[model samples]
Target: MTNAIEFIHVKKEYQEQDVIEDLNLSIRKGELFVLVGESGSGKTTTLKMINRLEKLTDGEIFVNGKDSQAVSDRKLRKDIGYVLQQIALFPTMTVAQNISVIPEMKKMPKSEIKKLTYELLSKVGLKPEDYWKRMPNELSGGEQQRIGILRAVIAQPSIILMDEPFSALDPLSRKQLQDLVLNIHEKFDTTIVFVTHDMNEALKLGDRIAIMSKGKVLQVATPEQIAQNPANDFVRDFFKASLVKNIYDVYIGRVGMVQGYITEKPNQKSMLVDSQETMRAVFKILSKYEYVAVQEGKEILGYLSRQQVISYLSEHEKD
Candidate 1:
């Protein structure tokens, strides 16, 4: 499949100091690609280059196969959604108006914008009428973040870039939003480029994750692949610091996520759990019964068990 985005020998430097060193990557159409690294790893810098928020210091970026530089900044950005850590929803504006900012800029009809505002708010678990007149201050941080996400995708952009969008929220709220992003991705079939310092977030959300260090691409692989086999010592310890966190994120209602542990294959008789659900949600079922099948959409990846989960956690402890 033609990639939705491609980075070719990309580099960025300040005062002749390289921040992104010869980076190259490809993001497939409709797939969520995550960039994970410590601060100054250039993940955010890479995302900025896509929208021309930061001018590329070197190399080329192709969005939807066309050179990103070929498109003018204003027009290109109009087709791409962005959510920041702070989630800058205009404090003064009502929720509807906040969401309608870009659509209004695009000269969308008032009726259409109104329709879109309601649809988007509802999709993110808010009602239009209730929230239409509410200002940012009236909502909780989680609600505001949800609204910010709705605003980003109000235009239904083909690509969305998120920079640690949930890092500011409490763990429960963050998990909810992660589920929201997964839902949005399914609904829109969008190609997402998410940057995060959280390994658990990357594993939970990314179809593939690119791990970086000091401006270099250290490794790029699926969560299971990286967990089972890290690129090097840095990648190994990178996952280690958060090993318990990773297991929590991986196991919570999501046996399908860590499917490599399943010894028995799933079948029609197998108990079913949504791939998006977490281990915590289904612990009773797992403890009472021996296993439950983990599924995404219609496909069953495998069966999950509490024992296997406990065992996996023990093995990965690096004792």
Candidate 2:
């Protein structure tokens, strides 16, 4: 796939101190890409460079294959959508007004913009009649974020930059918005560069994730790839912090719940096991069969091979 964004030996400095060093990365078009790391890891700085929220001290930055510096700031930012942790809505404007900001700025017909705004509001489960004229201050944190997200994509920009957008919300709201983001990505087929310090969010949302640290990117891979094969000590330990209490938790994190897994029916001879079964019980079943069907209650989620279980265990045995 072609790149939506590319960084060529990029570097950034703040007050004579290097904030990002020799950073090189590519985000593919139409993919939900994640940049994740602890604070001060340069993930946010790297994201800002893409939209010129932060300028590059050295090296080339390209958006859609053209040098970003060549594009005028107004044109560049207008084409790229941005969402922030602070939920930066026009506090003075109503929900409909906020969502229609970009469309209006582009001189779209007032009627069309209103229609699109209401449609999007309903798509996210926000009833138009109920929320259309409500001020930002009247909404809850999650509700405000829903509007912030809607505003970002109002212009149908091909690329959206989300910097810790959902970090400030409660767990339930965070989850709801995460689903909303996934749905929006699927519906719009837009490229998203989401920044987060949360590993679980990264694993759950990204097609591929880049792990950054100390102004450098340490590894970039699919969630499953990173789980099974961490690039180095930093990568391994960083992910390790997010793993559950024991081997069972670790196994579930890998197979059942972290990334989406498809379900397939088992054969007549296949043994069945509960996801909550102890590792010893699973080991016994695995020893006799090449693979076993894993289930939760009556639902058969998917199959896990003996080798797959062993491989996952060996990798996390140290934890």
Candidate 3:
């Protein structure tokens, strides 16, 4: 099957200098793809090139199997939704007006747009009746961001480009919005290309993550795959925070979820811990061995090490 979006030898240059060089990637249909990198790394440039917001200096970009540049700008943009970190909700417009912008631009009927406004607002947990007539100033930062995303997708675009949409919000609000996006993606099955420098966010939200640096892609991998096998030191350092956070999850959530997991075929010479054992118990076992294998019967779930536990706590403990 053809990819939802493809970049073939894509390159972007500014002031006779290349910002993106010989980049090639394919994002799967109906999956959330995340781009993670530091500033000046061309993640945003790559995104903008997809919808022709920025013309490619060289090479080709295909959206839904059609050359992106071959399509009319206005028409192509209408088929690609955009959400940003600083969500630009028109302060003069009411919530309904904001969400209805895309649909209205598509020349949807007023009646249909009205129905969709309510339906989508409700999906994001905002009651339409309470928020329908409220201006952007009246909504909280998080609420405004939600409305921005709602506006982007109300036209039912085939793809949504989210550029650090939740980066500006507080942690709690950011987390809420992340869950909402995940739900929205699952329900709509739209191809989403999310851009962020936050590794934690990338791991949590992406179906697969692409790490970029200096206009080149370092690795493209799933969360677990990347965690277990980083392509290089750069990729490993980028994901270190998320890896530590997962260790904390084990510390806090290790007990209850182990039910029904069984350990068998215990190699008499090997150090092992049953799945039912707590991380604290694993810590004690690790004192005698470099690491203790976590097994459920013949299946090896993973292993635990005292060094990993210490490393996890070192970051989490308040100074």
Candidate that would win on lDDT = 2
List the lowest-lDDT window of 10 residues for candidate 1: 250-259
Top candidate by TM-score: 1
| Ranking according to TM-score, highest score first | 1, 2, 3
Residue 182, candidate 1: Cα error in Å is 0.6
Q: Model 1 residue 25 lDDT? A: 92
Regions more than 4 Å wrong, model 2: 244-318
Each candidate structure's TM-score, on Cα atoms with residue i matched to residue i, is 0.79, 0.78, 0.78
Taken over the whole model, the C-alpha lDDT of each candidate is 0.84, 0.86, 0.81
The CA lDDT at 153 in model 2 is 90
For candidate 1, write residues 1-319 as lDDT tens digits: 8799999999898889999988899999999999999998889998889999988888999998889888788878888999999988898899988999988888889999999888878887898778889999999999999988988887889999999999988766888899999999999999999999998889889999999889898999999999999999999888887655555445444444444647567443446777656555566666666677777668766777667766765766553
Q: Candidate 3: global Cα-lDDT?
A: 0.81
Of candidate 2, the 10-residue stretch with the lowest lDDT total is 244-253
Off by over 4 Å in 3: 241-312, 315-319
Please give the RMSD of candidate 3 to the true structure: 8.9
Error of 1 at 156 (Å): 0.8
Q: How far is 77's C-alpha from truth in model 1 (Å)? A: 0.8
